[model samples]
Target: MNRLSAAFIAILSLSSVAIAQSQPVNELSRAVVQVTAPDGSGSGVLFERDGELMILTNRHVAEGYTKFVIGVLEDLHQPVVPTFTAILHSFSPELDAALLRVTMYMDGREVNLRELRCRRNASDFCIPEIRFASDVRTVSRGNEIAILGYPDIGDDELIYSAGHIASILYEEFGGESVPMWFRTNATISSGNSGGLAFNPATGEMLGMPTSISSDAETSTSLGRILSVEAVWRALEPDRVMTTWEEFLPPNDGLDPAMDPHYGGTELAAGFEPDLFEVEVLAGGSNRIHTLPMECTGYVASAPDFRLDWSGETTQLHLFFEAFDNSDDATMIVQGPGETWYCNDDGSGTRNGLDPAITLDNPAVGTYFIWVGSFGEGDFIDGTLRFSEVSRNDF
Candidate 1:
């Protein structure tokens, strides 16, 4: 009887794994999608695009299937398993990426891609959605990054691995530089081919997961990933990347990101490891790179849904210039669970601490400043600045 009981437990464990694979997605499943390949199954992200498209999965999955199957649980009691039904729309074999259009049109039954609120709006061009890392002010070779996927995993199979970002093949990070690529320890399983690598700090979308830590050979655990640089190049204004080789380009996508003056270095946590020459002064006001906003009369601001920071006295020093006479009302500041730091006075600076503030305390590398209103009925515009540098360099 004891032996039989143990056998039952083993079977249950195996069955549980199967269920996880088929139904519930990992913590990051909101952006995950499973692709049933002729050879085997793999994973991909719900690539952000107009609802007009079905979903993007690893190209090889529906590559051979002219009409692919897409499965989605009609009800919660059913399961998170995809309903295996779709019409192939487009494919790029070179990148091993495929796009399929789901024809079922099941509305009200399940949450669809239309739910994600897009904060990024760079209307100048039509490139793949790329989110800059607001939490990781600086990126290095050792910073931890997680890759989410559903490689040949069974039903209960969802994998999450943390690894150091190793190399910046294309560029140190983002902007109009070369195609971006990063390397990490996170093992890319067979089913995780088209998964996603997210910066856990801010929940900001980084890049699509590709290649395994161990290549076709189960040899080493050197996981590699490509950044939005590759995806952006495919959609640059005039930049035409017709081939994969052309996309990879020749120059190391490092120098520009390391340049503090021109590159979007302020957007990331700190300089990528390769930027040894760049120097960042501590306690310097980051208003230089912050968005320009002015105190526009105060009101009850919805508690910021952002959970990236922990602070007792939340002071906001916006980088703004007085626009006109209407801006004379007063600069007031308020936050949930905290007192308003600045009262609506005609003072140009809101915090009242100083014309420029160095957020030296707590030493949190990144934060977001939401601009709403001044006190009374006035208007102003300013930008948010970083009070502390990620890495302290004289």
Candidate 2:
């Protein structure tokens, strides 16, 4: 090769390395926050937009409490802890996802993202808001990725793990099937749930690290990522609270019975029975009920129907059938003495995407049934049937 061509190639390679070094991985690291509960801890993303700040984490991670601490890394891996109380903004337990809004202050002041800092040259520096990939669909298997979180590595330091996308999996929810998850060879531990998974090439978030699977024999760990699209579906505009008053001190408590806006649905006592009713007999045909798009709340949050089954039946079977294979739905049966039985994504014949419940020797009394949409503003035009079955059949 000529001397001039060789010199040009070296200069281009040098510039490429400089550009790669200037990328925003350091700033993205700041967006990963440590979420702590009374029982355990996990990682959450610090989402900030238009002057509003919120944290997104797994539903299981934020379960059982309305208040927790948001930990930001400072002083060379030590955490700056701030206590904040939050209300359940929205959640889908079947999806294992939850969105909580900070409501009140307990022991410390509210989190000021500007003051939050990360370490560089034995000093701290302010970081910018995290960026999310516009479309996860563009991501293909074998693409390089990075997973960042506060893993329980005997310290509070933020851990960054790198791996490649192994495969994409399509799962059904509420009757609709979509490519909702991707598997990676990243190392994720117990505290890595809800952590951010980013495309190293662009520093854009691809998904959240929600689960990990290990082959017992090979000891190979596979990380399961909930796609960013799923996160967007969970953060539907209708489900999000627009005003701050909705999450204030008096409303910050976790009990749905006490908070009217807890899950965007009123409780059982306030709910009136639906106008339509269907009676099912043993060895009888299935009764279909159309769940309109207006059915806004979720399985644990909405009141859908009232059922009276005071017959000489040993067991009762309920099924929620969706119109499409990808649509998702939830069912909750509140029975005698305020007992509750909830099911999401039916088992066996139902492909684990529909809700089904079998009550053996259920109390012979009136049962209030509630159905909820799995997706945001998702109108489920489906059929619901209840049948009396023999105990052995159940």
Candidate 3:
């Protein structure tokens, strides 16, 4: 082989291994692809093997685009962006999860993409062909989760942000920590939608950052992650990429209770005085904070409802559960200038909350703050649980 080509090969080998075994925080640009359109950018994880290729991002990330041709992780050798045939596998609008299949070049043998190492680590986790993590336990309120994506940051390269698991909203009707969503302190800039948020230990995916705080401020305080359940719901049973496939339901078939996708829920508009009492500590536990989870009516139908906020409450991810027994419909809304509003049908946070979203972000104190059913026809009938609510600044 020519000296130049040989040197290039050596570089690729070393860099891949380096990234695989270590904590390459915010280094998602390494093997992931970005979907750039006229006005936006999205992130996708690179899954290569068996001569087959694909990218995992939010369906909304593609924004109706049908091409995967971006090179990231700057050190890799594919200088010229190689275009791949992109196919939309499945999508769930409400959950905001999507999958794309990319036609790839393969030699004589099959290849599995996970074999490509990016972050160097002491342990090599043999990522299951279908790797996923569920029933996630928040180790700390400020349990940090790093994402791989275009950080809306105008730097023209992939950027990373660290976020704590902020608050978990587990509504009564919506059910179970909304395994579909998570809030974070990570700054998910303009172009970061659809990138991967994963656990460093297992290399198992946690979710993708879908939204970031859009309000104008010195710094944005909140970001959002779409859980794997979103991906499963949008994917065909045959292609569902999680531990869930073995007991895969019939196409589009779902059970309301045991299933992650569907269930009735009662949302907490906000905190009511009689609803809660606080407990401070000299030190904390595995969780940063804990909230109450049982009401009078539906104790038996409840999930864990245990609020585990680790780190300092400010750096913790507090789990919240709300019950709605008002017999009305409600919505969670975010408006401008701290004008949080709730009456009989809605809830919102205008100034942001405290404990802050993570250790880095700070509490955004705005004027508007309400969390109960608003107006008319927005309340409902059921018991709700709230993990905990604390103030934070990111």
Q: Could you say which candidate leads in lDDT?
A: 2
TM-scores of the candidates in the order shown: 0.41, 0.53, 0.44
List runs of model 2 lying over 4 Å from the truth.
1-23, 76-87, 103-107, 110-127, 173-176, 237-394
lDDT of each: 0.44, 0.63, 0.44
lDDT by residue (1-394, candidate 1, tens digit) is 6999999999999998656544322324544556663324666655445555356555545534455444332232333465535566665534555566655533324434444332353221111343445433246677767776666653524566667787666554234345456777776766676667777654455666766544456667776665644543333334332233333322212111121321222322232341222121112111111112322233222221121334432332323223343443222222233323332332335433222322323323333222323322323443323332322221
Q: Quote model 3's TM-score.
A: 0.44
Q: Write the per-residue lDDT of candidate 3 for residues 132-220, one digit (tens) a residue.
A: 56645443356667776656454546565566788654432223334556788777766677787776655567777887665566655
TM-score of 1: 0.41
Model 3: residues with Cα > 4 Å off, grouped in runs: 1-29, 37-39, 48-51, 74-85, 105-131, 137-140, 152-154, 171-177, 200-202, 234-394
lDDT of 2 by residue, 1-394 (tens): 9999999999999999757844566667667777887546788887765555677888767754566677765443565454455555666544656676655455646756555434453245344557778878788899988888888873777788888999998777546776699999988888889888998878888888998888899978899999887777756665544333442232111122332211222222112332122321111111111122212124333234556555444556777666666877766566787666766666763556767778887776666665555543455656666655322243
lDDT of 2 at 192: 89
The TM-score measured for candidate 2 stands at 0.53
